[model samples]
Target: METIVFPFSSKFLWAKYLLVFALFISAKALIKLPINGTIPAVIVFGDSIVDAGNNNDLNTVIRCDFLPYGQDFAGGVPTGRFCNGKVPSDLIAEELGIKDIVPAYLDPTLKTQDLLTGVTFASGGTGYDPLTPKLASVISLGEQLNYFKEYIRKLKAIAGEEKTNFILAKSMFLVVAGSDDIANTYFVLRARKLQYDVPAYTDLMVNSAAEFVKELYGLGARKIGVFSTPPIGCVPSQRTLGGGIERECAEDYNVAAILFNKKLSSVLNSFKTSMPDGRFVYIDVYNPLLGLIQNPQKNGFEVVDNGCCGTGNIEVAILCNKLSPSTCTDVSKYIFWDSYHPTEKAYRALVTLILQNIIGDFF
Candidate 1:
């Protein structure tokens, strides 16, 4: 039997008016939300901080495709995430109501709808420095941009030139990199240190970043959000490497991050004038991340010093495998999921701050 459902008969004018009023209220609420308008897509670039498992397919040891990495993700299946769950990029997409999940650009299972929404091109351990990508065997920012160009061609074929142009112009582009440049290039190997001092090296990074932003602007990216480098000195891996046996935050590395962020913010500020039609806003992660590390309890974290995987001091990527008995049982209590990446809870908290900061420039 067919069941007819209705609050009132169509003949009841009051019921119809009440329904329309409710819809109007709901629409107003949606307009006040972060994403007041529909975005065509969200193009991503940068390193592991925003990588949505692009490294899984790459032939490199700098990967997190095994167990203990995505233990907190849906169904507990590892998906090459450096953390126990979603990263900042994923959270940002959710906040914008674009898509609850942001698939990797390289994901073989990606559908046409996924392309219509957004995808990530970020790879673990990549940076502005050319050698940084080489060292990790991951996609570099330059190569990522090349892929973006390819995507544009493919999208144009599907959506046509006019619609594709409109989509690309209306979409948001996010950049979060440079941590590996400092950690892997300068500190770990000390290769560039011989040729350039700390200040000079930072200048090189800022120059590369600026060039990338300008290139993106030229490619019709009107709304761009460039992420500031987080405090590298405070991460568990850096702490173990540079901190004393007690494991303290390395002040020198943090200073480099601070200097880079200062220069980056100022440079992006100039973009407002140089590219009047474009909106280039610097998203700050340093202060919030530092606060999380300094006062873990304030943010509902119990373990701020170490990660949840392995010993939490040195283990990361494959090192924090399921085979490792030292991996923590409770990822929720930890601020970091591994040596360099934060836990999902912490990432959610930090990404909210990032969203708040970009809401004005973005929506």
Candidate 2:
């Protein structure tokens, strides 16, 4: 038989094979893989507990847009934030490698760059009802939802519909409200005393919260995280008002909060069952916060019952933010930053618990 000699040498053939293998490896390495991590954006709605300075731009006395508020931060300048450093939402973004600053919705100066990460519609002293007293021109939950809708529209306009959909579908939705409803409206303002009994009032709060969640789902929020009310009675302002110098928390308010949370959980479970596209998660800030307050030593907190600023009374209005307001030397030692909000250290601890699978099943 005529020998049909190969044109290439053995060395050349080996070299070709090696090149093909290298190419294969390079292609495998270059291919993008689907990530099972958090979404690119986070849309927050609620009260001061999660407010990332939404009230800063507002012409309100309840604003924290001044010095000493962000003292523990890198710049050591207040960014209108309520905490000494960062809040729970800020930490959540940090955990996900997202932006550390959650932009305020009404900030006229906010650029497109700010929107790429996320925005917070939460305002200090805001609640579900519009009937509540206007606390320094803050937005209500309904208004916050409307702002969220506008934000989605703005995102669509910039990133196109597909990108916006992806963001809403995968991004986390955090709602931390209802504390103001109890502290400001119900107990202090006596809105509940006028309208309904304790149990009835709790039902109303939970029902309103459920309705708000439903509205968010309609607006395309998929992964939802709702923070139930903390021990509202344990707040310094409430403690001061509850008794005569004992600083004892009002059990009545605490009981109402418990009932509200139970009902809210049930409503969330029902939503998950009914809405196939929705993922409603409940964050229990009540027990963890209460534990920290009851046992400050266990949580590394020093002043659990009093705020770090002012007279430690129920006077955290605009007057507290005066140019020469009194402030503590070490804010980390205090649980409450003001009468109504938590310190940055406390918020960080709470955020750590939320991100470390303590409430993972709900999410």
Candidate 3:
């Protein structure tokens, strides 16, 4: 009963209409998203840098399971934590309004409910390589990732797939290993001299670390924070070996660490670009800690060069915990807690710098 009129061709018009509908749906999905109200659970994985008390369960000679280790912590009982107090993960968890401590994965006592909050897979004296001799029956980076996978599976069982995915998607991942790899494997074992040239060895270490990160990504880790190596050459043990008072930071070791960090940063950037939804951040412990050491007066620290435990050599193995072992009365002033670790005060300051976004760009 009407004159039939077509606006151009019906086929082309239908296609355009469909395209417009698709674009509208996409926009809606991107814009009108539901806000995630829950705080992301924090999962920690690394070495002593973030280890809470995993070494307590191990028979490691390199342990802090005695007096002076937990002097700054509540109750003052040795918790096998390397520092006098909380580690980096603990501080980050506090900032996130999560649990006060990150629980160890190997703790047989941990229950099903604990998995919801998150767990720590870090072990003291562990490394990327399994062959590297450690103080305890240490866990390698691969082992830590495997433990994380197990944790996620259990989490899925309890929280269900949808909720578990949401938690992991928004959760923070803190990785603070690699120092032991250099300290124990490269420097102590003399692998740097025996196995490969410096540059080649650095690449090997960084690549191994990168692979571990990729594995974590595959397991649904969306937010990651990786710590670059601190100034290893400046550690009391290394410096002691360099000759006391005349002690200088081993530039060779520091150079290797620098090279590793540079390569690690590059790799992380590429990884982030490939996975647009994921966030990868690097914690530059090297410069910030180095700055504190070089300019201790500016940071309100008194002792910059030596540790507060045992001797100036900072010997913190089994010998450091003996009855006759020497310990500084005031641990708050010293930068190094032992030969290779930081004092609680130093660690706290480091945490503050991170929370204040001093090194926010490299993440």
Number of the top lDDT candidate: 1
Instruction: Give the TM-score comparing model 2 with the true structure, all chains together.
Output: 0.85
lDDT-superior candidate, 2 or 3: 2
Q: Which portions of model 1 show Cα errors greater than 4 Å?
A: 1-36
Number of colliding residue pairs in each model = 0, 1, 2
lDDT of 3 by residue, 1-363 (tens): 112232424657744644553354334331221232234467888788877777775666766778777778879766778877777777766655566777677766676656766778888888665555343467777777887888887776665676577668767787887777776677767755677776887788788878888788888888787889888888888887643477888777788789889988888889878987777887788999899889887767787667777784757645556452667888877888877788877887888787567323322
Residues 1-363, model 2: lDDT tens digits: 122222233657744644553354334331221333345667899887677667876777777777657777768877666777787877777666566667677776677866656888888888765655274378888888878888877876675565567678767789988887777778788766778787887777888888899898887788889988989999888999874478788787798889889998888888877997788988888998998888888778889777887765664646456453567777768999877778888887777776665334424
**Residue 309 in model 1: shift from native, Å?**
0.4
RMSD over all Cα atoms, model 2: 11.3
Worst 10 residues of 3 by lDDT: 29-38
**Local error of candidate 3 at 301, Å?**
1.3
Measured by TM-score, the strongest candidate is 1
Candidates arranged by lDDT, highest first? 1, 2, 3
lDDT at 273 for candidate 2?
A: 78
